[model samples]
Target: MKGVAESRDRSRSVLRIGGVSGGVFDRFRSIQDLAKDPSIHAVLFGDWISEISMTFRGNERASRTPDAEQVAFEMSFISALKPAIQDIAKNKQRVAVNAGSCDPEAMAKVVQQLVKDHGTDLKVSWVTGDDVTTQFKEMLKSGEKFPSLPSDTPIDQWGVEPVCAQAYLGGVGIAEALRHGADIVICGRVADAAPVVGAAMWFHNWGREDFTELAHALMAGHLLECSSYVTGGYYTGFKKELLQSRNCTNLGFPIGEIESNGEFVITKEKTAGGIVNVSTVTAQLLYEIQGPLYYNSDVTARLDGIHVADEGPDRVRVTGVVGLPPPPTTKIGITARGGWQAEVHFFLTGLDIAEKVELVKRQTLESMGEYQKEFTTLTFNVTGSVAENPKNQASATVDLRIFAQSKNPDIMSAGSHKGVAPDTPSFAKWVIENCLQGYPGGTPAMDLRQSTGKPFFEYWVALFPQNKINHEMHTFNGMTIPVPAPTVTAMYPRQQVSYDTSSPLPLDSWGPTVRAPLGHIVHGRSGDKSSDCNLGLFVRHADEWDWLRSLLSVGKLRELLEEEDTGKKIDRFEIPSLNAVHFLLRDHLDRGANSSSSYDILGKNVCEYIRYKKVDIPKVFYDRGTI
Candidate 1:
């Protein structure tokens, strides 16, 4: 084996990698930009995976051969990327991606074919064995158990049989593919940041013991993994006046220049839209992370003391990331047939809105009667305000959404229910029949498909020991290299830390106060991790940090999310360096993304919603407009 000091190449040490897509539809313009940048060593595309991949038909057969339609859906990015791929080949650069959801080998063949048709000699290879749908069943039969995350419940209690399963593979296989001269490496079900880590490790010749370098690259990958997120795409806190100037609509994807010293500068295409600064990087750092330890299959990133510094315009330097050995296990996403779901909305508007809602609900319940009993889950969500005012009908109208899900598909079907008599109408028909009897202005949405039962999948995330996985690298020239197990061990904290009881100066001491949305003085970013939701709240001014930390305690968070809290566990952590407070709302998402019933399934909008909650802002800080 070549040592880190002797094997690395430094001419391309800048490690310029641009993120093309977060999923299938994320910004595609970056690919062309990547092709134009000769210095860029590689291009990493996150692409669509898991529940998102399920949108394509035949995803359940990911372990098997994909049909032409499935292959077309999976390789849709390649069509737009052909010209870019040719440019990359001309520049002698490489591409690493996890866009090959279930059939990476097949995707690689298509890519190779594209290269051949273009008359370029670029080689393509794909990593395999991430698909564990068959192995999972074998393991379960042999007495292996895969417990659910956070809850630690037995897999059987998940209430659905897994249709397809995949383990989060490491980046080593990708590196091996690169080492064997593969110009493009396609992967399936690897962690989102694997491509960056793989490319950085391969370029720098970093060994397993180079934990610090790996950690830096991991954070770099994390910052760049979401494409435009680190480049002002979600930085709405930048005041309307300032944000509008950046023309965020045509946001550019990020490029990280990672170095061997374990430090990197995050910058995007200069000609593209959006801004990059300490604020954007910091917000992205605090996005969707779990506590202090950010674990990946390759290595664990200790983010307790991470720092983001403003180097210059459109550039941010991230440093101080600590690294630990890789965890013993990897997270496996087991997708199961959750059941079927059906939803329809009734518009309730104007005077007597409350009465109209109640009338609609009462009649809907009565209409379903015994049929409702067959539903495994049912919900009534009333959205929008009926504030007293002489406003337009649109302002006064509220959407009363009725949603139901059940393992018994017939229960949620448009025209059938196992429990109901054959002659009786289905729930949809019943609801329509009662529309005439409902409130005077009640009207259901015109889309009839919403009332029909459609299959939904439950995403059960569990930890599977890395050693049990059959991970390997498939070289461009038909050779396979088995990936070794991680050298490090990891164990989560046995107990969570209780909230800090320290008190701060009273709100009155900060001078005059005004009741307004907390967003005016604070910024927040929220995202989902499995069934849990991570919410990071930050303040622009150092002086305001203390106020934010003390004011938004667990108790305060509970009060703010009281209606939606549902008595779930909440863990809060304070990061003084970033002037931020992070909270993990356990079991907040009804289930994982695929099975979630909420409109904001991924919880991406939770931060904005929390920002809308009214809170007292000190007039002094409020005046600075830096909040």
Candidate 2:
């Protein structure tokens, strides 16, 4: 295998980093910090949208109410300046961000509204014509049909919820956003490279036909997207304190200074308390990245052109990046409701029980025969209590999954306890989803996804064509309910309100300005039986604060808006940090360096040492302050 390594030379250098900071969206930070210095030429990458951001007006903070995503995005434009609107006023520079999440069309209008409110008659461009949710329709209309993500299997046998589907389009769509004389651009689901690509393309007036140069710029944007996470946040050597001063709080965002040749250095703010050495950058460069070679929504990059070296205490420069030609077909995400599915579990076991299992299942089926016929279909698969992932945990490899789905509600009532329980496994044990709350009756049929209902597959990246890229955001104006109401307590005199900060409510239960982790729902989803899944969350609140306090409190507010176990908090990581003790099985379970990523498929390097057994990763990232 090729060893983990990097090359340090004079040519590969980072003079500056282009970045958009703050929390969730770019609201938490201001470009003024970087603009004050001559190093940075532009600001980039602002994520707009979170429970509060899209619904409310800010990233969840300890002391916040909530606002709207549109408001948050508009506010970010101000932060990217010497003075509010000054950069755009002089036509000096600007930044691009995914200001909208699920709906781009609405995002356009939101910006248009903001501009109008500003009393400026800017000829805003509302770019549309792309929606992955209707990928099937687009393909049909274009006189072609193709499979969906990953394996892209024929849709004839699959049910796909076009929840989020769009190819990685460069910022070209925002071309119109710029051409209309709009200083700011808002897009949805554009590839991470799109903003940088769009800005460079429009800023330099590069044509769509220049594949080689655009590819280079696109590659640089890919390198800058994760900010510190790519730099020292996920460095390879933390033992020397690379992670010591890392302000999880200040967590520096990424910055890039692209040269005319397409090479760019990814770095962060000065005195930022994080390490930006070659090792740290090299690790970041390798993340989620496929090979020594680099790939982007636009082109395949020749990693060989890249270079790295220390320019100063915290600055590490990058240079030598080149890109190849683009692909042919476009990618799309079409959501035509997948069918319905309901599952009821029956816990049963015998010391020598494989034989008894068949008897019990057959008996249950006979009774539900009518319900089964009504539903149109029934499926029976078995495994372990850990019914989903088929990893190393197979000690008890016998479990059953009874699933059935149908278009009609009357037909869905088929798998009822009234239908399957009385028939077989008379002493049939435990059941969920079917026997609704103490009262055994038919439950509402849900679209139980095969990926979530069970542990199933491995992880892989699916790269699609670019023409399918759309950068539009839509806002569903509704009184979003809190996951679990933030148990409120008013502190009148001091102007304070206390929230549980651990709101334990499902995404659907979310209240205005509050949302569960991004793609959290996708965690429980099983891609296949053989893949081990790791779970984590990235929450985005769309709005920005007029003052500084808003950025400081998103984390606190998230906690406050949440109730105990009512929601997942960043503080859930307490086991090793809060104590000085180790458990009997600590060696086997810690996710650090030795223990497996429990269920992590993203390849997150969370734990330090377990299987090999140690409190710290021997040499990687460690606190130098302690030593």
Candidate 3:
């Protein structure tokens, strides 16, 4: 708490931020919320999680419709939150967005119409450069050829059918809209992180590859893109306090304070219904993190040497973001045929949670044994969302869940049919007499999805620098500000240098390139650690790669390393050639998740192992490994 107050060095001139989140569905709500503020220099949206857009325009008859999948994407962000955005525009507050999902072309028309209806002099343009579904089809119709990824097979053989095909565009497309004198810019499939970063770059007139400037924009965008995550939305325990303190219904939007190094701290406007604390920020830092390296389509911002300090009240200052060059390839969202997947959830509240779960498990297994079902697969769970270990408590309750999948229709039908609930002895007595909707209501149908397509790094992220993506856009009415113009700039493009998929960009993420000076290169090494202590760090994007390099360059980095790793400056060593190992580190103390740079929930020993990497020190070390 003491450190939280001193977190922000007021002497510094960084454009700080309020908060951030990774969920894509907040686009509409965020826009609606922030739109009310005329003081906002600009607005930007970074979304990839949901397809609110497909819902807004009311997609193709179910046959060709893209799945909503509960994602919070742009299209929905805007339409759902239109009233608030209009109020912002009327107030003359500047805003922007890239929440169009894969329908930028259609979204473009929507924006023009929306602006016109508002009767504000706000000129609007829907930016569409990456989505080439029509272009690809036209080419195929006329016999032009194109090569597909992996196989490089001709378009005809690839059998490409995109309900939406938006190429991730960058600053160039954004600038295109600005040049046309558009007030609100709309884009589809741009990098989710790019819109806000682009807005900052445009607002500050920051150029591409101006490492620090690029870092600033990247940092700002990162903090404000997510709606409530930064502002008590997903805050654990903190939300209880916020809800108790203020109206939970009026959730606040995140605001950011960005610096030149692309480091930012998030805090909402005062009296807002959210709490900006270390846990919320750090949770997001570790949430969905692949590992040490984090990537996205536009740039890779490294978390090395990263510091997050809560600066009292609502301020949280963050630093040490490393930036590197972007990769040459782009990541494609390939939803390949994943077959049929379905989930069912039910609550069991009468008795012991464990007891209830065991009974359900036993019954389901027994049913499977009797039928020798060929097309059914199931795993029952006691919780929801991301998995967590169950804890037993008195009168404990549980939400039972079942997941199943199959490819054959007839064989699957043998498992369970729809329009009727499955009756088993454990729950059969409860269901037949008083059956409700949620318990095994329908037969499983074959669901198909292509894999999350992996694209190259060249695809740029576009932003409509005019609005935030919001889910509950009605909140914009609270503020009477008018939204203004668009602002944007792209991160430096990835340099050409490689071919290898063995190393993925971090983990779950399928993107982006390792930046030059930071990504996919071989650099300095210790003659001591190995013949080649030289390592290759592939982050999710260019920003992360660059940030890693910066962390190693800090004045205290080498001094600290020398004292700890044996009186020698291991980072000072150099080598003849560095292939794909991105950058050189004079002294890098690479470690696992328990690094002291992060929250230390572990005992003191593990803390020291993270802080000093000591076998034994002033304090004894107790490792999680030991536990």
The global C-alpha lDDT for each of the candidates, from Candidate 1 onward, is 0.78, 0.40, 0.40
lDDT digits (tens) for residues 1-627 of candidate 2: 012121212242322436664235443435545444444543345544322232222121111335533322344443443243333333334445665544454555665565456554433343343334355345545745354332334444443322333343446655434433445555654556667776655545555545556766776666566556555564434445554454544555667666555555656776455656555565444443322334444455555346666787656666655555544433333323223445654443323334445654565566555554544345555444433434443443444556555544333333343445333321112223224332212232243333122111111113333434333422222211111111211111111122221333332222233222212111111111111112121111111111112211335323333321123222111011111111111111111111112333223422221111121111111211122
TM-score winner, 2 or 3: 3
- The alpha-carbon deviation from the true structure for residue 213 of candidate 1, after best TM-score superposition, in angstroms, is 1.0
**Model 2 lDDT, full chain set:** 0.40
Prediction 1 global C-alpha lDDT:
0.78
Candidate 1 stretches greater than 4 Å from native:
1-9, 54-59, 62-73, 241-243, 415-424, 494-498, 501-509
Which segments of candidate 2 are over 4 A away from where they belong?
A: 1-17, 21-27, 30-41, 47-93, 115-126, 132-135, 138-145, 160-165, 175-180, 209-212, 236-243, 246-248, 291-297, 336-627
TM-score of each: 0.94, 0.50, 0.53
After best superposition, candidate 1 residue 228: deviation in angstroms? 0.8
Candidate 3 C-alpha error for residue 341, in Å: 4.3
Q: Rank by lDDT, descending? A: 1, 3, 2
User: By lDDT, is 1 or 3 better?
Assistant: 1
lDDT of 3 by residue, 142-249 (tens): 775444322234445533233333344444345334433455666655555566665545444455555455554554565555666556654434424565675466
